[model samples]
Target: MDPPLSFTVPQEDFLLFHQVDRDLYKILVTELSRDPSESMRLLAMWLWLEKVGFHNVVKNIMSLPIILINEIADETMLCLTCLTNNSNTSLTTIMLSSEANDIPLLQSVMENEISLKFFRQNCMEAIHGVEKTRKEVCMRAFGDIMQRAMMRNIAERMVENNNFLFGSTGPINLQFGSVGIAGALGQQHSNNNGGRGGIIPADERTLFVTFSKGYRVEEWEVREFFTMAYGDCIETLFMQETQPNEQPLFGRIIFHKVSTIDMILKGASKVKFSINRKHVWVRKFVPKRTNTDKVILPGETSGFGFGITS
Candidate 1:
């Protein structure tokens, strides 16, 4: 089949939104492929919707919000249709250079698995419509995508730290604990450990806590339950916020004395608690150290396993 060119969005935009796009693409490939799960169709669409919304905002196109949503939503449906029917239509070809291949993101995916390909009579078909309810759905979808990308908190902080960004109150979190602090210090978890502690250091007194695989235990439930066993020895209790329904997220319990951790660990990596029909666990808290803040030197790879050929 003769390859057709698609220029609905600029080529550079794909590389610009690479992380979110790539993530969305991976999900789409799985969901839109043969044997697609009818159960997961809604989830796949939400992920796709958020990706498109993020692009709309960053590019400052500000088209009617509904337009972008319908455009992307349609593309999603079209791709699903293409895969399901298994039509004999020639697989879409994107030349990187041909005048070459197609859009970088689309072209790159086609280079991978065969069943994940999509065909559009024209690229513009994928983008050009809006529904009556526009901005609200758009915002929620985009915000959720940011959460999936783990960039929502940083965006929230950027909003709060700047007077230019806030409206009357601040943006409301969609998730229950979306904006709530899952981790904080002492009687009032209003503060963090405040960098590394000076004297004993936070880790010496902190015990890492993990729950069972089935349920998501809340931060408060963890604190109240553990306080019974460890007593007032608890200095602070904190848990990381993640999916409220799926994998059990972990937490930290800092005791007043270092000996508490010794008693809990007892020369093992972790200690378990089976109380009130739920199993909880405790270990030593070791803060993750990352150089993500540091800039890559001129010749360094970006850690994507590929060198900067540029």
Candidate 2:
């Protein structure tokens, strides 16, 4: 006995299927319409979905028409690339580009599952372009902020210790020598002193630290080390040459404020710290008023300049 079999979907079930499809379309449009900040949150959700092996859901979202895909920014595209589990496909490059408008490529990606090597190459180029644009924007914004902040005299003084302004914790190399904006400002302030080369006022505000005898150190390393110890209080540091024929072997650290110097000196008259296992001695730098002023060290009968070994 043979009986004809008939299958029919209930009317209510058919209506429910259409409702779900429409809801999904609305959700996708809403997600694409979000701002960049909100898009980042959505990206995190998409990444989680991908990690959980929700491939179909990811495919559906990514394969949206070109008009919908173009609404997303390049940053969002980069985020999407991080979740591509398929070695054969670069969904980011395929779906998030001007080439998405190409009918043949779009059809191949959507239907035939095209796997092109150039997709990865183009994706990398787009990512790099986005990064370069962001970096330039940040630098320009920072320069503008500094210009406004430095308009006031006090703020300009603050800029001396703010490494963000000069790009690092050391002196900027000028044609004359390695010097900082603080040193330049000090030189300008002391213009009234006349003829004698600009000398920074020596008090508790400055320290003359001698490195281990015969131990060589780079200028940047000294700046970085001291900056870590003193933070923004350590405005500038430079090597001092005690003898004309000898290489500069000592570092002079200048504090941004006299108060910081007083605080450090009160804790210790002389400090002993080590850099790379080599001993360093730190003492307040007291500048001599006259050329004849001299210092005598233990076991040495003749007087010499403050930092001179002999």
Encode model 1's per-residue lDDT on 159-179: one tens digit a residue. Answer: 545533454233332111222
Residue pairs in candidate 2 whose N, alpha carbon or C atoms collide under 3 angstroms: none
* Candidate 1 CA-lDDT value: 0.39
Kindly report which residue stretches of model 2 are placed more than 4 angstroms away from their true locations once superposed: 1-202, 242-247, 291-310
Q: Against the hidden reference, what TM-scores do the models get?
A: 0.31, 0.28
Q: For candidate 2, what is the TM-score? A: 0.28
Instruction: Assess candidate 2 and give its lDDT.
Output: 0.41
Estimate, for each residue in 3-80, the C-alpha lDDT of model 2 and write its tens digit: 211115454554353343333333332322223333333333333333334344335545443222322223234344
Most TM-score-accurate candidate: 1
The most accurate candidate by lDDT is 2
